[model samples]
Target: MLYPSNYVNKIIYRIKWVTQKNIEAVENKALKKEELKEKIRKNSSVNG
Candidate 1:
């Protein structure tokens, strides 16, 4: 089956956009985890 060039381009663009979004989400999650750990460390230091 043959597809139009524009249709193929659209699919490629969408895949790229979704992949970039996924990467950003993973990075954000890691950052949040680090922030949570830092907060716990600060609280423990203050209490101890």
Candidate 2:
């Protein structure tokens, strides 16, 4: 009854939180990769 509802809500909230965190982490990693690629491109063009 009441306990089950509370437990379900808590579980859902935690799942949502973890999912959002994982999405954000992936987005950040993609951004860093892009930045590194840009840096490498710039350096290669300079040396070549």
Candidate 3:
């Protein structure tokens, strides 16, 4: 089997872009979780 260089490059570029997006999404979710936890802790301390 054979493929053109440009075609292979396009596929590699797309894969890299998709992975980068996924990594960013994961990071954002983690940050959101941390923010939520902090908010809950603050509220609890204020009440108590």
Candidate 4:
């Protein structure tokens, strides 16, 4: 079987795109968690 070069390039590019999206999702989730922790710390200090 034979495939076109553009077809193969498109597949590779899509794979990279998906991997990058997943990485960004993970980083965003981690960043949100850190922000939440900071907020909780600030609230606790104020409440005390």
TM-score of each: 0.94, 0.89, 0.96, 0.87
- Model 3: CA > 4 A from native: none
**Ordering by TM-score:** 3, 1, 2, 4
Q: What is the C-alpha lDDT of each candidate?
A: 1.00, 0.97, 0.99, 0.99
lDDT of 1 at 19: 100
Q: Which scores higher on lDDT, 2 or 4?
A: 4
Candidate 1 lDDT by residue in tens digits, 1-48: 989999999999999999999999999999999999999999999999
Better of 3 and 4 by TM-score: 3
For candidate 2, what is the lDDT?
Answer: 0.97
What lDDT score goes with residue 28 in model 2? 100
Q: Give the Å error, residue 21, model 2.
A: 0.4
- Residues 1-48 of candidate 4 have per-residue lDDT tens digits of 889999999999999999999999999999999999999999999999
TM-score of model number 3: 0.96
Q: What lDDT does candidate 4 reach at residue 4? A: 98
Candidate 1 lDDT at 22 equals 100
The residue-by-residue lDDT of candidate 3 on 7-31, one tens digit each, is 9999999999999999999999999
* Candidate 4 clashes between residue pairs 3 or more apart in a chain or in different chains: none
